[model samples]
Target: MLGSLLLLWAGLLLLYFLWKTRRPKNFPPGPQPFPIFGNLLQLNLKNPMKDFEKLSKRYGKVYSVYFGGKPVVLLHGLQSVKEALMTRGVEFGGRPQGLLVNDINENKGVIIVNYGPSWKEQRRFAMSTLRNFGLGKLSMEERILEETSHLNSYIDKSAGQCLDPQTLFHNALSNVICAIMFGSHYNYEDQSFQSLIRMITENTKIINGPWGMLYDTIPLIRSLPLPFQKIFENRDKVKAFFQAKVTEHKETRVPGKPRDMIDCYLNEIDKRGNDGSSFDDGFMMVFLMDLFVAGTDTSSTTLRVGLLQLMMHPDVQARCQQEIDTVLGERKQVCYEDRHRMPYVQAVIHEVQRYGSVVPLSVFHATTQDTQVLGYSIPKGTMIIPNLSSVLYEEGQWKFPHDFNPSNFLNKEGEFVKPEAFVPFSLGPRMCLGEALARMELFLFFVTLLRRFQFHWPQDGGEPDLTPHFGIIQGPRPYRLGVRLRGRQSG
Candidate 1:
């Protein structure tokens, strides 16, 4: 009986392999797949971007690779990426489903939902909410300046000691997001607030990490509770926090005055009343979580990377400080417009984004209808990966694509000139919705922090490791630095 059962199981496994690896006619060329596993084993799961970048060199511009038996078309080089994302925006604007996506909000939010009317509504509402909340005006700048001051004060309290600024930076950014979404911000020492920040930051790291990608490629991994328990736990904690806030808003909402994004959404829901629009309480929770999480991780990580890059190149840091000193002398604070005056500083900031390429691979895009990228027919529902890392670091796009040089953004005359290759926020309609807001935060925070403090690798301690913890978003390995009030030096 045991022998017979084993034979039956082996035959079933054989059938599964035969069925799973079958490809459609005219599929783009790619590495051969193995039984059941597909091309996952070929990838360095911890650093998939490097593997993909390497693949692009051999496979030419448009190519396919199997991740867990599914074909993902990777558009390499700047031209192909632009042709797909920018030129054929609608054709390649849909979001594909995955374990992480479905498990959280069931693909309801702006980032994960399919390209359709629902996506259109949520995106429109989100942008409208930002506008109504003073996204680009002086009011928004005031809020950011307040949070920037909070970050500066925290560093001030450190008194030049060796301290990791990771959590501190996350806290300040979280406050800005909180104020925008929930109409309130938290103190850095608040225990509950700290917990929420960890939940958001850590899970994003895990989701972008190798294991996260692995689970994403294979849906079966989602059923195994033990491997990704912490991620799910964080998901639950964050949603619960959002839910609680929703409940509070529901109970305490005013009839006329809409205080924040949440209140605006809730009021919209009531007004819609039975129209069956996508404005339910559940949708509100997911949307807020989406905004909160997306808003927190990217900006904070950008700040962290910029700080590390500056520390490693003190000469560059000195030049930037000199520029800031010369440009905004005696102006206790900075606004977004100041970027125009400090060209070197602007170049360095842009370089940090290009070199880091935080979201190395953009959020997965899908073919809305039958599409062709570079003459390769991509069927409807095919997953599209416009490797922004490849575009940012593509050989011909930047003079020194491999190096972390600010000159990449500056020309012979030493003025800031943005290369067409610098699309860190990505492209097309589904591009990062918070692009402007994030740019504003990075500028204000970098200038504000540098103007007040000079950061350095500790004299008595070891040099900081520049190696990034590769994930969905690449960020510097956690390290401490010494900080003290800057002594103004002339250029």
Candidate 2:
């Protein structure tokens, strides 16, 4: 009887393997996946970006790769990405369920939450509220400029000394969002805010690291204690911090009058009042967390990488400063509107975003329903990985796609011209919620800093490494810059 049972189990295992390895009819082609393990073995979890790029060459763009028996479509190049994210956006606009990020977030936030009533409701509300609170308006620019002043002072103190800008930029950007979220900004010396920034940095690193890959691929091992567990721990701590803020808001908030995002949300909840809407305290906590993380990380990382690029290319830096000086002319501060008059400076900032390619993969998107990309059928709920790096660095897209050159954004007339492929912010209905605020902040901060200080690689610091340490967001490897006050500095 024991021998018979073993034989039956062996046959069942074989059948399971076959089923898992099989692909649906008309599915985009890719490397054959291993049973159970799927294509996990084929990727370098540490950083699968280059691996994905290589596979695109072998399997063509819009190919599929399996993660633990689940097939995910990887969209490459400008054409495929545009078709999926723009032409057929709604059909390909759902977040993947049961992933590490969704699980950690409990799928309540605006980012990873599924596309449906709740997502629609939260997104609409967030967008309107942000605009009302001055996202793209002059009021919002004022808020960002205020934060830029703090950043200038912080850097001013370290002038002519070797200083690492990682934390400085992170803290500055975090405080910018904090004002919008909490109606106030934290002191540069605040321990709690610093801790919060550290957690966000660590979480972004882990979310794209090897452990995050392992957690996503193998369900059987998820319950085991592992480094990925730290993600959950960090999530809990962040949730608690944001939750406390929510509790405090509830105490001080007045109905029909909103101070910031939290106050606006509370007013919204009251207006909806048990209407069975997605508006509630539970979702609000995660929503706040999402806004904070989204608002802070990418822009900050871009600034860090932008500084590195400037240090490496002093000519680019000097030219930008010259443009800034010519345009501002003793103004003592730069504004968002000033970008129009300073085409070269605008080009350099855009190039920084292009060269940085900070959020490379662009938060994983899933198929909301059955869809077709370039005639290949993608089933409902299939995972979509848009290789934005492909388009950003596509061979024919820009004059110098592989190198950092402001000319990428400049026309022969020396005017700033954004190419169709310059999508550092992913294009779609579900594109970055904080896009306008980020653009304004990047312009104000970069212009302000370049006007006030000249950033250069330290004398002892050998060749600056242009290669960014890959994460969910790419950032420069830790390096310090020597700051010298520019002639006629901005106050």
Name the candidate that leads on TM-score: 2
- C-alpha RMSD for every candidate: 2.5, 2.2
Q: How much is the lDDT of residue 224 in candidate 1? A: 80
What local distance difference test score does each model get? 0.84, 0.88
* Model 2 lDDT, full chain set: 0.88
TM-score of model 2 vs. true structure: 0.96
Error at 8, model 1, angstroms:
6.8
Report model 1's TM-score to 2 decimal places: 0.94
The residue-by-residue lDDT of candidate 2 on 252-291, one tens digit each, is 9888888899999999889999899999988998999999
The ten-residue window of minimal lDDT in model 1 covers: 482-491
